[model samples]
Target: MAWGLAEFDAERRGKKEGYSAGLSDGISQGIQQGISQGAQQKAIETAKNMLTFGDSIEKISQVTGLSEEEIKSLIK
Candidate 1:
C-alpha cells in the first residue's frame, strides 16, 4: 500500500486536533470543580466563625445556606 503526503498529513492533523480538544475540555471541567470546592470551603469557614461569635443557628443557616443540622455540628 502507498500513501500520499497529503493523506498522511491530514491524518496526523486530525489526531492532534482531537487531542487538543479533549485536553481543553478536561482542563475546563477541572477548573469548574476547583471553583465549586473553594466556594464550599469558604462557606464552611464562615459558618465556623459565625458559630464562634455566638450567631444563632437559624441566622447562620440563613446567611450561609447551610442546614440547621450542619450548623449544629459546627458548634460541637
Candidate 2:
C-alpha cells in the first residue's frame, strides 16, 4: 500500500511539472506575439505619419526600419 501511494505521488508530481511547463510556454508565446504585433503596428503608424509630414517612402522606411515597399504599401 505504501509503495502504491508513492508511485501515485510521483505520477502526480510529473503531471504538475508538465502542466507548469506548458503554461509557461503558452504565456511566453503570447507575450512575444503581442510584442511583435505592437511593433508592426507602431511601424505602420510611423510610416503613415511620415507620409503626412511629406517624407518620401524611402525616408519613412529609413526612420521606421520598414522596407520602402512596405511603406509604399501602407500608403496605399
Candidate 3:
C-alpha cells in the first residue's frame, strides 16, 4: 500500500540522517584528538630541548605545562 511505502521511506531517511550525524561527530572528535596529541608532542619536544640546555625540571614543567615526573622521564 501507498501508506506502507511512505512509512518505509521515512524510516530509511531517518536512518540515513542518523548515520550522517554520527559520522560527522566521529570526524570532529578525531580532529580534536589529533590536535590535542600534536600539541602534547610539541610540548614534550620543547621540554626535551630545555633539558638539553640544563634547565631545571621545575622550570621545564612550568614553561611546558608538563609534570616534573614527565620531564624527569625525558632525562633518561
Candidate 4:
C-alpha cells in the first residue's frame, strides 16, 4: 500500500518524520554541549592548579586557552 506524502505528513500534525528526528537532534546537541562544558571546566581547574605552582598568567592562558581576566579571577 503506497501512502501519499501529504497523508504521511498530515498524520502526525504535519511532521514528515514525526518527533523522533527532532528529539534525536536535540539529544545530540545536548551531549555535545555537555562535553564542551566539561572540557572548559577541566581547563579552568587546571589553570587554578597551575596558579598554585606560581605559573605566569601568560603561560596559564596559553595552556588553558582562558583569558587573562579569567586567570586573574582565580587568584583569590
Candidate 5:
C-alpha cells in the first residue's frame, strides 16, 4: 500500500511539472508578441507625427529611424 501511494505521488508531481513548463512557455510567448505589436504601433505613430511636423519622407525616415520604403508605405 505504501509503495502504491509513492507511485501515485510521483505521477502527480510529474504532471504538475509539465503543467508549469507549459504555462511558462505560454506566458513568455505572449509577452514577446505583445512587445512586438507595441513596437510596430509606436513606429506607425512616430511616422504620423513626423509627417505632421512638416518633415519630408527622407527626413521622417531619418528622424524615426525607419527605412525610406517603410515611410513611403506609411504615407499611402
Candidate 6:
C-alpha cells in the first residue's frame, strides 16, 4: 500500500541521517585526539633536548608544560 511504502521510506531516511551525523562526529573527535597526541609528543621531545643541555626538571616543566615527574621519568 502507499501508506506502508511512505512509512518505510521515512524510516530508511532517518537511519541514513543518523549514520551520517554519527560519522561526522566520530571524524571530528578523531582529529582532535590526533592533534592533542601530536602536541604532547612534540613537548616530550623538546623536554628531552632541554634535559640533554642540563636544564632542571622545574625549568623543563615550565617551558614544556609537562610535569616535573614526567621530566624526571625522561632521564631513565
lDDT of 1 by residue, 1-76 (tens): 7999999999999999999999999999999999999988888899999988988989998998889998888777
How many angstroms is residue 39 displaced in model 1 relative to the true structure, after the best TM-score fit?
A: 0.5
lDDT of 2 by residue, 1-76 (tens): 4568889999999999999999999999999999999999999998898899999877888889999888878767
Better of 2 and 3 by lDDT: 3
- lDDT per residue for candidate 4 within 1-76, as digits (tens), equals 8989887768877564668789899999999999999999999999999998999999999999999999999886
Residue 71 of model 3 has an lDDT of: 87
What residue pairs are clashing in model 1? none
Q: In model 3, what is the error at residue 45, expressed in angstroms?
A: 0.4
By descending TM-score, how would the candidates be arranged? 3, 6, 2, 1, 4, 5
User: Against the correct fold, how does model 6 do in TM-score?
Assistant: 0.93
Per-residue accuracy of model 3 over 1-76 as CA lDDT, tens digit each: 4568889999999999999999999999999999999999999999989988999999999999999998888888
- How many clashing residue pairs, candidate 5? 0
List residue ranges in candidate 5 displaced over 4 A: 1-3
- Candidate 5 minimal-lDDT segment of 10 residues: 58-67
- In model 6, residue pairs whose N, Cα or C atoms come closer than 3 Å (at least 3 residues apart or on different chains), thus clashing, are none
Q: Candidates 1 and 6: which is better by lDDT?
A: 6
Candidate 3 Cα deviation (angstroms), residue 11: 0.6
Candidate 5 TM-score to native: 0.74
Ranking by lDDT: 6, 3, 4, 1, 2, 5
lDDT of 4 at 63: 98
Query: Lowest-scoring 10 consecutive residues by lDDT in candidate 2?
Result: 1-10
Candidates' C-alpha lDDT: 0.91, 0.90, 0.94, 0.92, 0.87, 0.96
- Candidate 5 has an lDDT of 0.87
Query: Residue 75 in model 4: shift from native, Å?
Result: 1.2
The Cα error of candidate 6 at residue 31, in Å, is 0.2
Q: How far is candidate 6 from the true structure (C-alpha RMSD, Å)?
A: 1.9
Query: lDDT per residue, candidate 6, 1-76, as tens digits?
Result: 4669889999999999999999999999999999999999999999999999999899999999999988889999
* Cα lDDT for residue 47, candidate 4: 99
lDDT value, residue 69 of candidate 5: 90
lDDT of 5 at 16: 100
